[model samples]
Target: MIEKLAINGGKPVRDTYLAYGKQYIDDDDIKAVVDVLKGDYLTTGPKVKEFEDTVANYVGAKYAVAVSNGTAALHTACLAAGIGEGDEVIVPPITFAASSNCILYCGGKPVFVDINPDTYNIDVEKIEGAITVRTKAIIPVDFAGQSVDMDLICKIADKYNLTIIEDAAHALGSEYKGEKIGSIADMTEFSFHPVKPITTGEGGVIVTNNEELYKKMLLFRSHGITRDSKLLTHNEGPWYYEQLHLGYNYRITDIQCSLGLSQINKIDEFVKNRREIVNRYNEAFKDIEEIITPREDEFSNSGWHIYVIKLNLDKLTCTRKEIFEALQVENIGVNVHYLPVYLHPYYEKLGYKRGLCPEAEKLYERMLTLPLFPKMTDKDVEDVIRAVKKVVDYYSMENCPL
Candidate 1:
């Protein structure tokens, strides 16, 4: 007989709740932050440059610009790319709203693209069809830590003379065709939020190989005010600066960078642990007819930020919400990654309507993220698996309640 689910008052598989994603902070990380707090600089200091250089070296990029948050990083990238009114940027709807919101921030229209149902990244085949004379760029997001089809995306961008601003917030440690995600795109953005692969409390960075773009991002990160002697048009003396362009105060703090420096040192290990957890989840759910595990392309090694499972609603009597709540009852902190960006009320009022991307809306209805983090132990992984299986089995169509 199948075990009763916790939603129906059965014993929970876990006594404590497990979060979907969390940062693994150690003593070293704390020490680093504290050291920065006691240092000579706090905001625009040597530590900021040090962190940028470290990220650049790690991702094999020519330069990196640390910013206050992921959204700021995206906005800075848009500014550097010269996205403006009447310009169109192609983006997938399945990602976080910030991915497309950055375009709107720059007075550009974000053209929503559907995702490949399997990989859940923007569909390469349909990208070209979205291109128009007004199209200036494509912001392909590396969803759920899996790198988007960069090779195909590059080809499309080259053919259309469009810039590629890859949103790699979930893919800092991920790899595509042996190259790191940051080094592949024209400008790649990374987030250092607490739940990300690495944590800086709240921080972000943009890395690029083009020096021109790099300098542009640097100015954009610092209120467009540059004291650089080379860039200033007129220098009164040694204490002169210029605000050449309109920019925001997107600068990141040295304290955050200090934490980031420590966190990045363990990124490989964190990624390894996440992948191992994903492997376990995949193995346990492979034979369950009510579930469809995430798929990774053979050419990619995902950083596995969050493990999401798609429910086979056809085989289950319960809705995704029912299953989500059921898992929560079993102490699993299951959550939805996103609703389609354009489906949000803000975007809806902006003239975007439903049925914009059929595939994304469908996937959003069926998908939910599972707990996958470096700190989760073997027992925690098993608890998640057991609770999921219990909930799914109880809700299976064959076991429909009277």
Candidate 2:
């Protein structure tokens, strides 16, 4: 039954290796960085404000605060939201470590919730059960660029007086219902890593409608120092500033902002192209019995960050690790999205144990992220599909024994 396997020496799908996700930097992106290099005030400058305003306008938010990276943005947002020691923030287990790490950064605890098996997002129903007298906020991640049910999340937040910080690192161009993601939550954080919808090398930003939170985030991004006269404690001279609160040096550079501005101009095209790729992948994999394509929530128009598939291990004769190795042998660089955050050693040390979120643990074992980036050509998409089919066919129970 295992005769069809690639390990027995069948030809691989492609001649070269393909990474799971990649950045697409055009000539314009390079020129934008070059222009920033020639300009004065590389950090804390006009370019940064321009990029912030552009994103603010795009996402329909009143204010946007640029920061060093996605994790920094999360931390600053938590700080602005008044999270502190003994506070508890509700988070989904099926997300990047930073989503929960930011809570710890503020001396707060993370109360993990499981995910909806179909959407792979935080289950709103489970959230209310986890809320306690110390509950402070909810950080629902838009995992894989699809927005969670914002209306329901907002309703829950309002009922409990909890702040909402949507972790939109994977969901820049995504929409919840007809509204853009950034404007719905109290504060939304976005990442500009190479693998994101846009590329700025490495950068992140937080957008909000609250003026008080906006100003606080600005102070937190740059060592908590404020040079404005209105915010100062005294009428000290030109170079005088006040340390308003304890904050971090999480400022983003003008070089990164300039590149981000250029990338923002092409966001529509980028999102459209990514959707096209996702559609093709879904169509190709639907008929295969060994896989389950990711399901997009009906209320969302996803930005399509990573194209993840769930292997139907019940129908497969080989293990997930075996299939992963088979894909690598075919030069298809597949990867796993996450292991439940609590399962990480650091969280275990914090007293979080396994079986806390059963669905997340189950999802982690079966999920596989494939190559899906805006710059991938049609041939690249086809090559990935072909490789997946080859691996699945070889491991099918009909061809192999369990």
Query: lDDT of all the models against the reference?
Result: 0.93, 0.93
Per-residue accuracy of model 1 over 1-402 as CA lDDT, tens digit each = 888777787899999989898888999999998998898998898899999999999989989999999999999999999999989999999988999999999999999999999999899899999999999999999999998888899999999899999999999889988877889788999999899989889999999999999999989888899999999999999989999999899999999999999999999999899999999999999999999999998888999988889999999987999999999999999999889999899999999999999999999999999998999999999999999988898889998673
Clashing residue pairs found in predicted model 2 = 1-399
- On lDDT, the candidate that comes out on top is 2
Alpha-carbon deviation at 231 in model 2, angstroms: 1.2
Model 1 Cα RMSD, Å? 0.8
The model with the greatest TM-score is 1
